[model samples]
Target chain A: MIAALMTKKEWITNNVRRKNLGAHVLGVTAFAGGHIAVHWLMPSGQVVQDNWDMHGLEFPSLTVELPEMAWDEREIHDVFGYRPQGHPDLRALVRNPRWPDEFYPMAGLNAPQKPPWREVAPNNPEQTVEGEGVTIMKVGPTHAGIIESGHFVFSIIGENILHLDLHLFQNHRGVEGQLQGRLIGSVAPLISRICGADTVSHQTNLAMAVEEMAGYQVPDEIKWQRILLLESERILSHLNDLAQIPAGVGFSVANQKALTMKERWQRGLTVIFGHRLLFDTVHPGKSLAMDTAALGALITQLQREWRPWRSLVQGHHGFQDRMKGVGMVRQSDALRFGGQGVVARASGLTFDARQLMPLYHGWHVDYASETSGDVSGRFKVRLDEVEASWRLMQGVLQRYQIHSALPFWEPPTDLIGQAATFSESPHGLNAHIVAVDRGKVIRYHVRSGTFRNWPLLSKAVAGNAVGDFPLINKSFELCYSCLDR
Target chain B: MGKSIQVLQLRHVDAGSCNGCEQELTALGNRFYDMQHSGIDVVASPRHADGLVVTGPVTDTMKRPLMQDWDAVPEPKWLIALGDCAAGCGVFQGAYACYSGVASVRPPDLVIMGCPPLPQDILRQITVWRKTLD
Candidate 1:
């Protein structure tokens, strides 16, 4: 007696319909024989992976009902040539201007030949909105500052932005494609470079997935240290953005002060972790010996430094005046957009990935982060988060000191398989899905906090003054390379 | 004699970095390293710069804009490749989307090393390069 097999679309629809509204879309990606994989997070911190087949047609369109699934579905279409039937604007997301037509890099085993380098990778048939007094303004592929390359198409009437569109992936070096057939252990350095500000978080998340595949249960003592490293990264990343905000409003004094704290912490990270950005703290088997005295002193120094800056930032009328009531994303719009991390939390939709991770259990930390979802709200979220991160680090340090002599958990070299994991990055919830076969990584997919939240940035910019775009942009501080990767 | 010569101005251009170089590059202007005191400035426009301090593996999509920045700068402008990726593509060498490094696009007059060379290293190399202007 054969059981009936329903279509992948129906299965997803049924799941979406039947669930008690606790379900959230994590990501969607196209893989080899596995076709399309839909990642879901339940209210109970459980991750459900639904494997959907293509029914043999190469360019299959798996239309998604949920609005947030549009980005992931379009990404699948861009790189793998799998069309998302219901996705409205499927203009190139990952496939930038120079990416040749009909060349799907990730779909086939053999990569296409390198096309001739051109003087201009023009956005063919660029998207435009025409109306009386609606002026088109193009900002960059190369910006006015030291920022990474990305183009912004702003439709404006005087100072008001009507619609904001962007051109990202100018820096797509084909990381996932390059990771194919590489040894799992050797991929840490490459992963760390995915983005600079969140280097530690990226490496830690990758380590979690790899260790899962290798069947390694990391020791509590070592896990605490990893958490501390991640929290420090959060503080540093928040500081980086904090500094940029002041720069946006021409508040150089505040900007310099923020830079001072950031620089001090990064310099101290080198002394403690052997890498300024904590890029060297990847391997878990080795016991890292950080001096207890230096750790305490550094923590104390940061606390002393951060408190005054925090007060100054909060009290400065000029700075607060510029940030408040600007770049506002209404709660209803935020929910509809399905944003995550700081952006979502600022907008009052509370879902933190830390609640799902087992490493974060047995601690009494406030997970509820709510705000008005404006530039100032994002500012307060980052400020409060930095404070929380430092305290979390202090707790981890205390625990590590108590269990200094515990045996480290050695990762087993014998085990193999795949795992999808989620962890909180400084930007928001960061997801890494990996599969290992014969000592090599066969498939790697990352759905960053930036990928989902970028659209929200455009949404926030709408009906905002064009001059305030930088302040709004800095408030989000999204990473272009992270999404492009 | 106090200082009499005009300071050098280099515009920083990110040609597809992972942004590690950017972290160090941003640090150059802080109170600690203080590139401004050393008679070096990171200008807002390529037209205002004496050199283009480039980073990353020079991804194909960024190649044209990078060349245009070079065209915008005046004659006798130097090119500085400021990390391992820009120096020789580092791990990103020969990837489908990139042109090895800034070297493949245009040979750099100066090259700083390290996955991201430290803020101190980047400043030191540029300080040494600052000597050649005389």
Candidate 2:
């Protein structure tokens, strides 16, 4: 049986040929009950989702045709024990290597086998390009910097990188597995903490899904307040990346200046939202006990500080030399890797969930662009987004009125259906799909922009100077922890 | 306030944090908190550190690396569990991937309790500890 969302056709569920469906896959997902849904972005600028019911726990491999679907399908295999039959290169993704191959965390502990650890396997170097003068370098699950845990296997000839194999999920904290069977509303805090860099996006996306499930309409005051938090958070996250890109180039002056600005912004956020990372600011239905006047003051203070600092860093020739034309990601590679947010826009793909998803509909989102798809392009994208976010924040703040509502998600506690939500975080498109059964979360899956954009880091790194990894990575500024979640 | 200060160099091990703690820990080096003002620093390697700053709930995958990094610190080194998750696992108590708290790996000399403790709080505590060496 085949179902289609293209050509304005209702999902026709019947025995139909496989070749009838269109290409250009945006993402592939498995909802509750192992139903594989393929979202296709058509030529008319409309996204159409086609879903397929798996016969038992097996689905035909779509990765054979669409490489972007690889991660999604691999994740489905790891968590749900659903095998993607005939797929090439199915390996451990969400699961760490130490876990027994049979231990699928999403299978619910009540099923036959209980969750247990197995003895660790010996460390084997991951695959690399092999030939004369080719050397392999491995850097972190630990690094020289105050950064998250992830490893990179780079194959290089002299200073130029031949290829990069990124080994992630090294710190897989089992966030999705942990959320099972918890009350729908109770999981927002945990969701918010999925990754500090993406706190607001995670919470807001979850809130949207749960709100959809409960048929609840957020009041106008709270809606604007939520937008305000999202934009402020966007500024903070992007600022961290801006500071990082400079440090990659050993430009301490710009790095420290950006860091100082970030700290100032975070302190102001704490004054208004009660959390540094904007956590707890976007819980379902609930409004904050906020200082609305302080919100205005914070925005004004940051704007006063931003102008001179921006020009000083952006104009630096040393920083420009390191970033421009380094680590270029082809637009073709961007599309193949399921590029979503910053990377896609920088690489000349006009695919932003902000513009494409219903979650961000009606909001005027102005994004930055760079056709070269180089390190400088990604850096400029973040720099531009910082201002775009500030503008969006001011628009919301101008319309914001103090809302005195109580703690918020699904209050009626009778949520029994499935809903998916998306948000354009500072990182790009952050997504969450949740299914509640009698008020408890039965199935939850998160696909962050980082999860989608990580492969692009390797794609861009090839042929660039090996030392360029840090600058290239910082330019994209993808979150390791969010994807680890 | 009259006593001379000795630097307390530290290395950070992100056992399995959601990155909220790392965000603040990194900010400690920025101009605002400036842990360096107190002669406290986050060194690149454990071999140069006087202590370990551990965050997250000790995920199963990170347990060995965390122990290896902690062992790399010179003797007389202390471990400070830097967040609610590291101190006692906070929201991740029964998570399958987590060992619950840093103590489950090795007991910490100090536990600073914020989901991610404020950068000021983190610096103040480290500065206070640096005085203990005097």
Candidate 3:
């Protein structure tokens, strides 16, 4: 019944388009009316149709013309029930290559049986290799280091690594799968969990998406508060990453000093935000409720406290020696992988989301980028970012004022309109695309900064020795859960 | 003179966790509550030395390894129960594999509260533990 309804709508749409009327009129009507009919020509010369609800009208309806000869040539008929007449990569899209022909009857259809594919290969290539006197050293999904979980399988030829493969995803929490059918408000907590260090940034992006979709306009005060929170998150994360660089190379003093500086920052956050990690501080449509004058006073206090600490770590020769020229990710590689935040900026990519696309009105931000692309360059970039964040916070506190109405705003229900919401997270550009049908979220997609940069970690580790894994890992600092989700 | 201390982290092994506890543990070194500078570092291996900071309740598969790790860490090392899961098994207590919290395997020198205590709370506990060692 649904397919027939879709077919009738497709016929009307095609007929109207053929008569010289605009297809967008029908598209807009279908989108606003809650469903769009998608028409496809089947391989058997029959036209098939499917009705998809237009929740978020962010992406336009697309129809492609394909050559019939290319359809049967590629095995799309085996995987998904229907095949596009022509697709560029016929063999590249299948999830399971080992599955039998009888399993996948058509494109988009269920397989007869689940293929015995390993989620993680235990004796992965990164783990072992055949070489004279080569011994396997397993690092961890859990390690005795200051970093997160990512098991390293290193084939060491007498303390020199011959092969190394990073095994990750031990901490995968299925955040995206948990987000299905949840209200915008309910998904904030889940989004924040994607990367613990960037909680504020994640929530900020989620909030922006919700606000844009609900057509809710947050006040200037709230926007500034969000910025402040985001900067704080950046400072905390950068400080942690900076400290780990020294620790990875076994420079205890610098590690300890960096940790001390980090503690001071966290204590300041706890004093003002009521939690050290700054969880649940910003929510959709809610402006951070704190006295501006008092917060300004606190920012001043942190600045005075952080300066000496920052100088101490930066001045250390031993720290600089280990970080310099270690785990260098060139500018070209950074650009190819679309790396962002301090990592990309350090590699000479000036693609800061805040500077690239300004979200807060009347606020100006200045940041520095370096082209060294080494661990030291990354460290310097983070240090500069932390200092810049501190300055940005001070500026925010000075300009902030008490407002009567809270900054919380709801997404608009209009489907025929276009809205894009963005936030410059600690990681990078966090964008949300929302298309509303009547008053419901038709389509919601979150493009986290971490999602764009994680693959670069594997690339950076390709030629480097086994010892460089931790340094390289810390350099990029990509959040796995964020990307996995 | 202060005794040189090293931290050894143990995975009590919650098969599927909401990850709130893990986040709290990760935040131990962040800029508002720095754990490492205070001589508290989360080491990857159990064989390294010093204290054990365990998060989550013990699961069936994780039970033997948890015991093995607890045994692996050198003697005179402190054992800390982090988060509610480590304290009293929290939400995953009734799961098939999970029997109890960190106490199920070994006694805890410290038990920090909250579903996951804030970084400050974690640092405070570590500081107190260090003082006790002195």
Candidate 4:
């Protein structure tokens, strides 16, 4: 980890636009005392962190050089009132019309002033494509079924789609704003709520980041337990995605079969770990450790449950016909958009956080990549990952022999610096940046896999049939709550 | 209005939920819970629904829509708050984005509590509601 203090202009010119750069921007965060930090990850797991001291809310934007920085910059603007001078699109990202114009929530700029009660626009209007018979169909903010609300406006002619304008943040809850001044230890439960499906990953990422801040390390047994929790989360989330795919194509039987397996898997997790979703199960330097016997039984149960569904789903031709060659994300586009996890892997980009980070070094998990970059590709990647997670759990259980749970390591109260960490979430790479001052959190930023992958969704859905939107969307499984948070 | 209804059509409104409640709600329809067997059907629109199965703490952005949907529900419709968030904002209470649960918008006939109540819990609540009506 390398942290450098540079001028905003120098930082942008030197690092943001530099050719032959090996790092990807994790996120841009803002601190109370005029500090702007950009967390980046080099190809070799090394974090190249840069902090610029700004007098006020003005800073040089990196959007021109790296388009992916646009969302982060906009969020920074919304949260901290940081004016990104050169940002191409400086529209309100998360701050809705309900929020007062000058009040910034994250920085706590205007605490005494309550935002006035007024009627506000429900969502931002989409940029429509103008042409003859180019009708637009808008879906969600409040969707059918139990899915997260995200408004997608599809400009279509007949059944073919021309462009999909996505408007997320309808569920934005100002999660970062709420985390301020809390003890580092108390933030896990709140972090878990950032996204429900990937609760373990969110907690692990936040936990790992806070632990890094305090310079603490867990015992091997606890480390394995954390990995076990993470892998279990991955398996269940991927299974959820798998079920969605079959359901998307009207294959209800296959869908139910997979969902039943997932339920059984989750039930086993609940029996062993005490929480079906495993919320608050992981904390800094420790996790809710499972007994070796229960874990073994869970693994055996999973093996028995997964085999039949895996065989049937993989062999089914109708499911394949619907999933294959649909929602294709090109290699160049994936790279350009900074795609991570299944979205990138399916596009043949071998960019998994586990492969890069030291935390997951000992875990013998296989990286699943498919060059097709289609719905089938993403589906196949998720299926392979579920199997890989199952294998990893089996491996961890075999190697670690312990009768009781590992003892928790206490975090030092004296924390003064920033710590950034990333984890392979079920959807993609989940990155968290934490800034602490004297034991209390000053700045906390969580960039979920959905945040990174949502951009790719708009790109991927283009040129596909209007009816294929659900299938394409289900394949991505991007959570609006995570993105909104 | 007084007639005993056979099929209960539920329209789910996500009033700033954490997706946890939504997950459990989705699971209720799966083979394990099989909510359809009990005559609870999740319709696409509130116009065609008998009740509103709501989730999340009513956020500023979603409050208007939630109220609009509530008004859209026909006479003799039930409003069931699905999780702690909807029941009373759960942990997300007092946050800037939240309006302190769906009860703030309109008091629910039934409130299912849990950070996110399980599918079985939801099924049990629906069954209880069914029994009371019968």
Candidate 5:
């Protein structure tokens, strides 16, 4: 049965190949097949087509059929080093054991067999001068401040960082692979867990994906509510960051002030939204439980409390001294690596998904960016963002009061379709792609803002002294489990 | 230049924990209960730390790293067991990787109980540590 399905898939793929039409091949198996499934995509946009087999096999295997004429045998050999026996090009191959078979699993019979392992040839090692006092300082995976776990091996020559290699992934949660076949509604909680600091942002992206998949247009009132919650998330996170910077520099008074303000913000969230972090507040196919009058009251309360605190923190000279130029990220770096949120905005890269691609279609939002890529830049960007969010929240509240009936749409009951959605999260622009089959999420791809900033973070730390690592890391504040997953 | 108190912090390791104690430890630096204002800071490297703040239940894999962290910190440092988990392994005592608490790895100078004590509670313990230092 397995062989029969593979042959049918191959035949279909070959026929499509002759017509220059793109085709996707998918395989699903039960019980004895070890529950292995394969999903293949062509250049043309098409939902993964499945070929099922019910065969008694010890291990599960899935294969994708490719056209022989159009196949790149040389590229395959370079990547996997397994050349098909009857393939056109078999000479340009490098045999290796570390080839990726786990990610792209293919059938063994039609595929090329594994080549012989090549012996690792040793290169001449570089000579090192014997130094009297050289200490290897390792900091990582666990540390002080609001930074995630990652190992940094610093070969220091008396306080100067001579060589540094960052080894991360202490908080790997495998969230991406876990999203496969999960119902669209079920993905919110999983997205929320991506990063505690940016919980609302991740969930918003997931919610947007679901909304898009279902062709459901969110009510204007709910949209405003989402913006309010998103701003609240920003205020809390920025306050937390601001508080940590002062604490790092041993400024007790400043740290205390920031912390207190942050607590107040959290408390307000709890009072208004029923949760401090607003976890599970805005979900797919659900309206915000809070009333318009209550939301307006909360907004008034927040405005009264936040204005003075913001002014006090901004006016502090000592805090400014510690923050300004502490960790500078250049605009070039930000643009090249696709840095997101405050990190990208601080470096003068103006890219906010809300302004760029407004999901609700007609909503207007105020966006801000900064030029200085230092700690001060990040602080300023976050500060400005807080203000912008506050303004947006107010706008949303006013709109909600005026617009009595908000439109809510439901998901289209169709199988084999794709939908993509983008939302402005606390971190940055979060994009989620949903492939659905009859209202169930067949596969979900979440490209979080944090994931986009990982490479930039590693680059930011490079060339800076070892002492500034903690401060630099805090400035970027990339989520570990979010990226790891 | 003047007489200064040297602080060396030891970060405890746990295989799996609820993170309640960690939150409390983090809260110590917040506005409500400012530990840094009291001259107490959470250091990343154990070598330069003056105290060890152990939270959560001990696990088999975490045993070596926890011991290594403890050993790495200089002598004349204090060990504090924070939370019920650190005091007696709490809810994860009989779980697969979890063994016990700070006692399983090293002797603790102080044991503060609660699933996770409040920031004020953490502040009170720090005050006690300062008094002991004097």
Candidate 6:
């Protein structure tokens, strides 16, 4: 259904009271046309949409009732110069003083009067720990490992963390702004790079959204091929996450083993697709070149190799000891904050988009969930998802025939309109919203799983030690590029 | 060829990378490549390192921190720019938040080019550097 626009006050009053509509805020996105689109992810996983037209630069904020709206609203303020009136903490999110507060990248305005760029004082919150032994520690923007930029400030008394604050967006590259006004066919590469590790997921989700907008129906053969690609991507990403847990615990043997499997899986991708990370492998109305025989062999190899390696990692007592109870995120907290993927599943919320949405091509997946709400529970969920992905891949290979020929779809000319799609990314639910006009993208917004789950990290590490932070952080295995973009 | 160090202790810096390079770096340490076997190690701190293995276009916010990391490594340390992002800013070139490439901060001693260079390619590059010591 097309989303209807309402005056800011009316939309809030009607939605906040859940008046005649059982809807929850899925996400809110701002565009260059000077409007905010609010999506409601209903209980049945169908998205109901609405818009708030900001006549001026200010609009009533919905964050008072929905704490999750804080980030969404602040992002709009940063990029579009639209203010969410009554927002608790409206600071520069994606932009710092280096870009000048007046210069909104996506506002797309003509040259106007502006002051010279200058470094602003860091807007980080002052430490509030009032006790005698409390101390503050800061990490990252550049961490010890091969990771992206983000700052975590921990207020601790000895080893127990009293409070933690996450300051992300240090790596923002104006990705969304870059997509604005580009041809629909051209943005796929940019979307793929939004997060390299999950390139397939981003590309597939964007393709689905574009296809929907253009009213193109993929052929059955290509549909099955896309499913195979999706499941392959999921299995490989889960394996990578599974390895991180062991590596964080200092179990080099298990870490090396799991990583080797991940490497082999990626090498298989490179052999078939010509890129280890599958860059530009999937595009709107098209699938990149693939050799059926190589794909079949790779799937078979993954199916055979994964079982014993999974057992080896899970059966280790020392690994279990480090993960069992560390970084516990309560079920209630996860739900309240709109957590998705591993963060939500481990806390006993079983909301996988593949099962709930129509994007899975009618295949029902049996996803796993654990109520333990700890690091071990998250690992268990990853293992279960990996197995499920493996079964799906095996099923695809089993159905393929050597003599069969599959056709790829071509993009339609004169494509126009808007579309929003969600898929079960390895991290969680990933949403891509696009608006097209005259075959050009006017606006694009990505609500990745990492953005949803990042808030949960601070809450999870509330009482954990500083040393345990890496293990806890790795369990979620978030993609900083996805979050930063 | 005989004047090279046997061990290359490196520190990774992510200025503004998409993390494609970081994944390859992790794979380099896996059983397939096993970087430690070649006497190449990734250290946690720059103070204990002989070089900085950098990724991504250096962003305005990360410029100070990246340079501080580079300065922390003692003399005779090398600067290796990994991936197209580090070499020429890749897709994020001319971005308002970035300085384009690592060369804007300092000339790189070695530049490995790819959207994200394959793990084997990275390992091979290091291996060739190791062979120069013979």
Among these predictions, the greatest TM-score belongs to 4
What is each predicted model's overall lDDT from 0 to 1?
A: 0.79, 0.78, 0.57, 0.81, 0.57, 0.79
List A-chain TM-scores for all predictions: 0.93, 0.90, 0.71, 0.94, 0.70, 0.92
Stretches of candidate 3 off by over 4 Å are A1-135, A155-163, A406-421, A431-447, A462-465, B1-44, B47-52, B56-81, B84-115, B119-134
Name the DockQ score for candidate 2: 0.57
Give me the overall lDDT of model 2: 0.78
DockQ of each: 0.64, 0.57, 0.17, 0.67, 0.14, 0.57
Per lDDT, the best of the predicted structures is 4
Please give the C-alpha DockQ score of model 3.
0.17
Instruction: List CA RMSD, all candidates.
Output: 2.8, 4.0, 10.3, 2.2, 10.7, 2.9
Residue B110 of candidate 2: its Cα lDDT?
83
For lDDT, candidate 2 versus 3, the one ahead is 2
Worst 10 residues of 6 chain A by lDDT: A108-117
**Compared with the true structure, what per-residue lDDT tens digits does model 4 show for residues A390-467?**
888889888876546666578877678877888888988888888787778777888887787888888898889988
Candidate 6 structure quality by residue, lDDT tens digits, A1-485: 34566666787776575512534455688866567778776767677677777777887898877676778888888878888999998866776666675778777632122335576543445445677899988888778877888888889999999998888887877677667667788777778888877777888888888889878887655566677777778877888888888888898877777887888889898788778777877766665556777887887787677778777877888888888889999988887777888899999888777875665656757789999999999999988888888777667666754335445566665578888787777888788888887778777888888887888898899989988989999998898888887
DockQ of 1: 0.64
The per-candidate count of clashes, in order, stands at: 0, 0, 34, 0, 7, 0
In candidate 1, stretches whose alpha carbon ends up further than 4 angstroms from where it belongs are A1-4, A15-20, A58-64, A110-120, A402-415, B1-5
lDDT by residue (tens digit), candidate 3, A188-301: 555655555677876776676666555677777777888888888888877777777776778776776667666767777777776667777887777655766666776677
Relative to the unseen true structure, what is the C-alpha lDDT of residue A390 in candidate 3, on a scale of 0 to 100?
Answer: 76
- Candidate number with the higher DockQ (1 or 4): 4
Model 6, span B1-134: residue lDDT tens:
33367678999999888888998898888878888898888999998888999998887677877888999998778888999989984987766666668999999878889889887788888778656446
